[model samples]
Target: MNSCKVIDEVVNKGLCIGCGLCVSACGNNNLKMALNEHGFLEPQQVSGHCEGCKGACLSVCPFNSKPNNDISTETKLANIFINESKNHNTSIGKYINTYAGFSNEHRVNSSSGGIATYTLIELLARKEIEYVISVKETITTDSHYAYSISSTRDELLAGAKTRYYPVTLAGVFEKIKELDGKFGIVGVPCFIKSVRLAQKADPILETKIRFLVGIICGGVKSTFFTEYLASKAGVDVAEYRKPEFRLKDETSTASDYSFGCLDKDNNQKTIKMRMVGDMWGTGLFKSNACDFCDDVTVELADISLGDAWIEPYRSEGLGTNVIITRSILADDIIKKGIENNALTIDNLPISSLIESQRGGFNHRHNGLGFRIKKRRSEGLAVPPKRFEKDELSFLLKLIHLMRMKVRKKSLEIWKKTKSAEQFDKRMKPYLFLLSTLTKINHYYKWYSEPGAIKASLIRKKSKIFK
Candidate 1:
């Protein structure tokens, strides 16, 4: 139940989500979070003076095994937080309400609807929370991002957009423990889960963390993704000044990915969404641990927010948010915001929320099962997951396998490329193969039925005959 045990069980097994709660749990400053060569945040023990008197680190790690009797207890606690009876979909978890909306003030500058920034501002204005912990660009290093604690409006605004790189809460958690008041936190599902786990072992965290704001996530990428994007934008990673992901463009689709960078000469450069290659599909520079994650929506948060990728809303380039309120506090805040005219929103069916993240749900829930099975077949150790064994079509299995393989190749190619053009040229064939396989898989699944082809033919013939 020491650092050694955590390394053996979680870090080595690739179950560590790199949330960095374990570092904060060790009060003696024995561990520090550092990014490895592959851009993964991992704990590095500074001092070996481990008496193992109290295994606070092990108790807080989400990946650790719990006794069989404790399963029901944990589930019951989760149900209490989730208000299980009100939940409509398992993928999205429990929510008091769902809505599509945007913050009038922050939408243009934010990655999505700006609800997260608005929510933090409201909480601060009401004196309900003293500080918020969120991710922001590191001032000294343009190629890196880090967790920051914001207490003022400008500070909150500075950290508004989505960060698509690796980040951990070890440093911020330390700051929270040092300071005195209630705080809100923003994180993806895995990081939120880590906070919940850490709270069980540390009573102070239970009292300090007054709110949890979660962002729905597909998966976290390695630092390599940032370097790749910088390379594609015609900036050397070391010479880049500041880089922002998801630079909002009013003319682009909500799903379009873009990057903005400043070079040493203070010249601005941008890689438009079209020229950046496929960010999600190719899965370049993705973390190994992300492949095993099952949570698409941040189920454990007080409230969760994500881009509303459905029609009409998706067409709006500023971006819209699909919000799910879980705790009563969050639900009340959202309702009051709408009533006060601080936000624009309309009620949305829970189905739309699920549909907005359909790809993520399928990959995390179903694709995870296939990935786990494949690992087991190869005599590799895999952590337990909730998804049951299901039959995978031949094409579906091949698509998943190839996606993983191509991602590794993409990382290699990215390292070798000296410029954006070279990276794009080298990646064309691999990207094409992945896209074609995905299309074929979907087409076969839908059109392979007997009447599907016949119906298509009849429609075409009717149009021609008319």
Candidate 2:
């Protein structure tokens, strides 16, 4: 079978994130994004269409690792915002200012303070963009949500809340070609980066896309993630409809939210995410591409939004958003919102914004380094990352390895057994080992601290006995 470079380099290596930029970038229409056996979207090559191809798909692929063909996210941001942005950092990238707050109007229905939704709406209201391209629920049963074009306030509002399930941009890119107006897109870091990469390779996209709004993401889950959750919640997967990944309870804190889904009969079932247990941190069902990604703040985006997963905001049931504004226009819209009382926000120190996503940074930064090193040691190809491979402690290495195993095997085990119990049983040994190592590393660091008085006391007592 003939294949595109993307298939041989990314998809075959398990690094495809299903962003679908490859499908949209294929000038010959040689590729189509389809759901694979693992329930993640990937580009499938059409026979005979790749003849004399110029490799546009590989050029735009986020996971593409072709030597000297790679365009780093940092370079992309500098090319666009070097003079516009006031600050830059390795972790958060370029930014004019960082803020922590939420839209007064959008917080109720939003997953996290509605900052992203509010920003997209304001950009439309201000006539900055002709349309907003974002993920929204579809009427069809084949997929719950897909990327859509929305120009109206109600349309944008209907697309609110977090969607953990996988989605691709193949459809929206096609729509962008048919539509004749400027557009703004909302996406996660990897998706936003892919769009930027596409724009560089395709002049048409560069002219049409006006703004990029980014979501601070840990990783995306496969469709099986939803099925597993629904199955555990006693909702019939066959009838699962209108699944809402984040449903807030006024009595509880922002992070303490529930997952809600509707049955065929329209009955809604709700379950707290905590009840689902440690799926996010444990990397269950996460795309392997996520393990290779290092961009946490969507550095290429004009502005980025994330759940303020810290402090008083965490305790606030209404939800809060941590934002990083990298473009002047994005900053202006936010400042105008503050002036009009449309938003209630505070200027956040960059440190505070970074702290809000400390776990994400640890994984993308430290954990990523370990994974790259391990892959290279095995003589396997790995995607190019911003940070170099790190020499990690043995325990840290074990923790990272266990995470990689969980992400890879979750889908495999689910595909075979389709039973959450079996999945959990198979995962127990990995989880148990990980948990033990984590505790040991934690205490070891604590006792190794310079002022660990308990350590000092123990040493003194032992010396006296000797």
Point to the candidate with the largest TM-score.
Answer: 2
Which segments of candidate 2 are over 4 A away from where they belong? 67-70, 81-83, 450-466
After superposition on all CA atoms, how large is the RMSD of candidate 2? 4.6
lDDT of candidate 2 at residue 377, scale 0 to 100:
89
Q: Candidate 1 versus the native: TM-score?
A: 0.90
- For lDDT, the strongest prediction is 2
Residue lDDT tens for model 2, 197-271: 877776788888989999989898999999888877778767788888888987889878888898778898888
Per-residue alpha-carbon lDDT of candidate 1 for residues 111-180, written as tens digits (9 for 90 to 100): 9999999999988998889999999878654336789999999999989999888888987888887898
